[model samples]
Target chain A: MAGGGAAASALSTPWRSLLQRALDGNAHLKHSTFFQLATVGGGGRPANRTVVFRGFQEQSDKIQINTDARSNKIGEIRNCSFGEICWYFTDTWEQFRISGFIDVVDGSNPEPVKLQLRERAWFGSSVKSRLQYLGPCPGLPIPDDDLIKDAHLDPSAGPVDAFCLLVLDPEKFSYRNANAIPWMLSWPSILVCYVNVKAGGAGLLEINYGQAMNAAFKRWLVEVNRKTGPPPQVANGRLHIA
Target chain B: MAGGGAAASALSTPWRSLLQRALDGNAHLKHSTFFQLATVGGGGRPANRTVVFRGFQEQSDKIQINTDARSNKIGEIRNCSFGEICWYFTDTWEQFRISGFIDVVDGSNPEPVKLQLRERAWFGSSVKSRLQYLGPCPGLPIPDDDLIKDAHLDPSAGPVDAFCLLVLDPEKFSYRNANAIPWMLSWPSILVCYVNVKAGGAGLLEINYGQAMNAAFKRWLVEVNRKTGPPPQVANGRLHIA
Candidate 1:
């Protein structure tokens, strides 16, 4: 019955509250919005880089990120939409690991709604930002070591063909606060318990469960069920972070 | 000839200089050494977390990280040694992405030299740091919501069975500085050129070439060769960050 209740609740609201609190606490710092995004690169290796968080998608919980369509990440998302984002807030000494599926909305996306969202995001972007798409394709060697000149894109120009808006629909979330308890959450069925013994500045242990809810995750679920024989409190309907 | 020269030179010295400069510039900040490590998880999705850099291995370029053998990363590395580390310096506004293979040295490892390295690292660790290994298996839920009691591991004891030393043998490195030009390096053969246009506090373009040196990387090499007809200066073995 507790498992059924957890499944019924689906998304965890308490985790969201905690994340919002961290965000609000560190909103004054510009770098607070910067986070590392890791994706499966060619040959199944991990590729990670910093990405700026564009606020949540209009009226929805999905995280928004504006990126160039010509970047390698676009191809990476095409091959495998699964991605993980790690964000650390310096002021609060808090860290968040969010794993999810990234939905790429580029010019070629068939969905009209996604295209409209892309257009709206493009209009919201400054002209200086839009001019980047007009430059040579990213990652290509500039011929003859020439410096890039500024482009003359109009301020009112629509979103360029290379503009893409990525929407990350989160499935699993993990939060760690140096001053408080660490909490983890997953949608529908999966749940994880994690502890990091940070005696010095270094973290001693960390575990990640991707949204697919792989074998280890399933095993963890069974283990939690077996260990907590008396019906876990959070497992019953309400999500708790304490 | 330039390609051969680059191959002969192997590791780029200029990139190392830049990294050392960043390290020296940010040595006062404790979190300067904290970086995000990304690895492939179950179902080939990306897993990322913050890890403290233990410094370069003894007389080697390999990055050192102290971890628990019982952690999920040990298993992840066993499954696939390929991993990437992204280090960002807040004060300097610089970022480094190092891609490489991880060499796991656990209690089960038979190599005496590596074992000695592990022992030396253990001796270097603080007593409070060593006590983490004595705690319950990480990521496993505690039965009945019980808190973890302090572990009383001896300061002079040898490395525990769960203590592991991860040596990341870097094959490719990318560096970005907000105040200067971005540079990239690869060992012996591969070379990558990347440019990120930052506008309004957001990076518009970035690229990653994993160490396996996949197809896209091969094509980039050819493109560089064809474009720079007069033979690139850096390709002539002298590592140049400019």
Candidate 2:
């Protein structure tokens, strides 16, 4: 019911809550829910495509997405399972860049676990969605970058082999809130500067999915929220530091 | 001006024309001109972020871009130079996916060519854009993703070491037009598939920068257009094959 938290939980609580809303997809219409996905292509280059938001898995570790099976992105995923997705909600300038190892869940997989995933994915594939797969494979020399023919398969029959549900198993996350950035690791924060400098030399520090610090961040958030209600500023997506 | 034309003159003219529009950044509003850029991260996962549509350079293979030198993306570019960009116009459903080797030009470079490029990039940057570079480097976990302290640098005083100009040296392109897909590589077009299939199997087919086939494609588009004006259904974003 509350939005943000007290001094100590300032960072973690609001951050988690916002992401949860983004994952939910339908709850809010104020900001864009679409996310841009990035994957390494066969030529070892990074390739990107736009995908609408799908619900996050129960544990919040894996994300689900649907795409045309014949798209070039599928081919890139085939080469490397690693991926990153960037979500930018222009309304509040709130952006989340999540990186993960990706897996394609399609009907072809025979494993029981994979089959279960495929079944769930298949349920989302409407007759219209399935038609995209049956048409000409994308990336072909079509006049425009879309399937030439719209194959309307009977909904009762269900999706064909080309219907693909992509799952992103998150490994890292970069959260940026441009609107309410108050805490700065300035010259006074020598320790932070040292850490940032070290990370800088290595290029960038990736937030590992299972880091002890992340657990600390969650624990800290829970402890702070146990007593205090969400702060006022969070309603507008502001992140106030202690 | 005719839209597309001649296999003999095909590759260069049409290829040049399409890119000129993509590069123009201001000419047409018929479709969404925004492009999504994907770059491989130091951690081996793909990361995508947005950059505004800046004008393209004429008679040059390299496409121009300006970014904060402190941003994680600039650092990512330092590590791996490969990338892919996807553009979609909501109105026409016209999209282009271009892949290329990436490069960044900054104050750090002493080479004549790079320095020249940086100087040109500096002239185009507005004062507001330059301030982003002087502030905290992006991705630093300081309660927000952007710099908390907005450090405004004097425009007359010139840029800090953080202003960077990036260029993408495109190596491949995937053009898809859902509006008028007259050429379907259907079962009948198996021979055409054989050629494209061969190209596909080898993985991403990087355009040789100046390819004869690409030139021919543009020419073929022109030839097709002379007989056919904007097909009736292109406005609704429909894919129809003849």
Candidate 3:
């Protein structure tokens, strides 16, 4: 029965594909509130913050987001490209967590592709101001503080040294969905994509039964289990995000 | 002038003593809405999650909180008795991120400590119940589903196993405060207690400047930076959660 169920799910990829399409069509991503981004650095420790999804391209697995070049994250990502990105859809009780390496793209390059990105940036800024304020300057009137000027000033020009473009290429992806069974259980079952970064980007995807998903959901779980040559640990409880 | 600033912030025995008092004081610890608890399995990676502080004991460095026994965190600590605990205070932009191992005290044991903790739990539950849910539990039922009754019931038995008790014993600690000056420069500093977990739990507390504090703060900054990583690479920037 389990095998048949698995096969049925596999064959129903068109439905899943359509669902994915609908999710991508979601207007929330354009509003910069749909995704959470985390970066790991300073000797491989992980740190996370939220970011907006600026844009996505299907043909090339690359994402584009902007940041201050002077922000500590630029240094962290330069040191270690591996980081985790999470997208939570509350309406659907669904979360997608992706881990990948990032590369900073140069926005000023005059190449055709780069030009296209620059044009998109102009449109992006027009739609929503992408400037960040560095807190109000003291002594100066709050209105007098040139926050936007400081944020968008060219890094090479010495005032806004933090402005830069960030590009991320995900290697691993995991999807979790909350399942509600009448009078039985209300918890999420997860489907994980374990990308073998060193293996030419081949992914091992697994659908987890709720109880057995905890350790498997963790990044270190697979490594530790393999090294120790033991069956994975499984526990029951809902996972909470802080 | 620099030496004067360093000297002012230096940890004299009296200053250390005062900081310790603040840590122990119920009013100081309970002032914060959230506190971070970090735990590690023996030879395993560290895990951190925020938990509401129930209270603290000045004499024993004992802290109390509620947790589900089924949590993977409980299992992690079950194997490894030592861990770190950190409490953050954002109002003053001051934080005390402490490091310590935990000892799970037996609640059923007839120790005076157990009685005190039970009383606190009773009081805490009363307060927690009144607070509206912290975050939207999307897809949560308006009326929670009750557990199905067992065919055979014991009259004398109480409520089925639900909540569990957790007690933390802190060992090492770090204190951080944000300092901003006029113009465009600001630096956040930290005093970290590098606990010696290996050699009988004795170690030096070092004051790391510039890079170290930035690194510590980077953990909190990652989420913000992610808001800025590249745009989503997936087509339509969405993941189908199933």
For all candidates in order, the CA lDDT equals 0.65, 0.52, 0.40
For candidate 3 chain B, the 10 contiguous residues with the lowest summed lDDT are B133-142
| TM-score per model over all chains | 0.73, 0.64, 0.41
Cα lDDT tens digits for candidate 3, B1-242: 11112222434332243343334333443334345455542234434444556555433445566665445566777776655454433333334544445655434446876656654454455432312122122111112212211423343332222244577654444443322111111223433322121223222222232324444233323332243332222124221111
Ranking by lDDT: 1, 2, 3
Question: Stretches of candidate 1 above 4 Å error?
Answer: A1-12, A139-150, A181-242, B1-12, B139-150, B179-242
Which residue runs of candidate 3 sit more than 4 Å off their true CA positions? Answer: A1-34, A60-64, A88-94, A106-123, A126-130, A133-161, A170-179, A182-242, B1-242
Across A1-242, the per-residue lDDT of candidate 3 in tens digits comes to 11122222333232233224325434353321334455543444434443545554334445566665555567777776655565544344344555566775445545766545644544454312333423222111111223223434343221122335677775555443432211111234543322221222221222333334443124333433344342111225322111
**Best by the lDDT measure:** 1
Cα lDDT of model 1 overall?
0.65
TM-score of 1: 0.73
Compute the interface RMSD for candidate 3. Answer: 11.3
lDDT by residue (tens digit), candidate 1, B1-242? 11112222334354555566567667777677788999998888888988777767655567778898877788888898999998888876778989899999988889999999999778876665676576555433332233344455557779988789998987778765543323333435444433332322212112333435345445644554454342233455544433
Per-residue alpha-carbon lDDT of model 1 for A1-242, expressed as tens digits? 11122222334354555566566667787777789999999888888988878766655557778898888788988898999998988876778988899999999889999999999888876665676576555423332333343456667767878788999998877765553323333435534433232332212112243435345445644554454342233455444433
What does the i-RMS of model 1 come to? Answer: 6.1
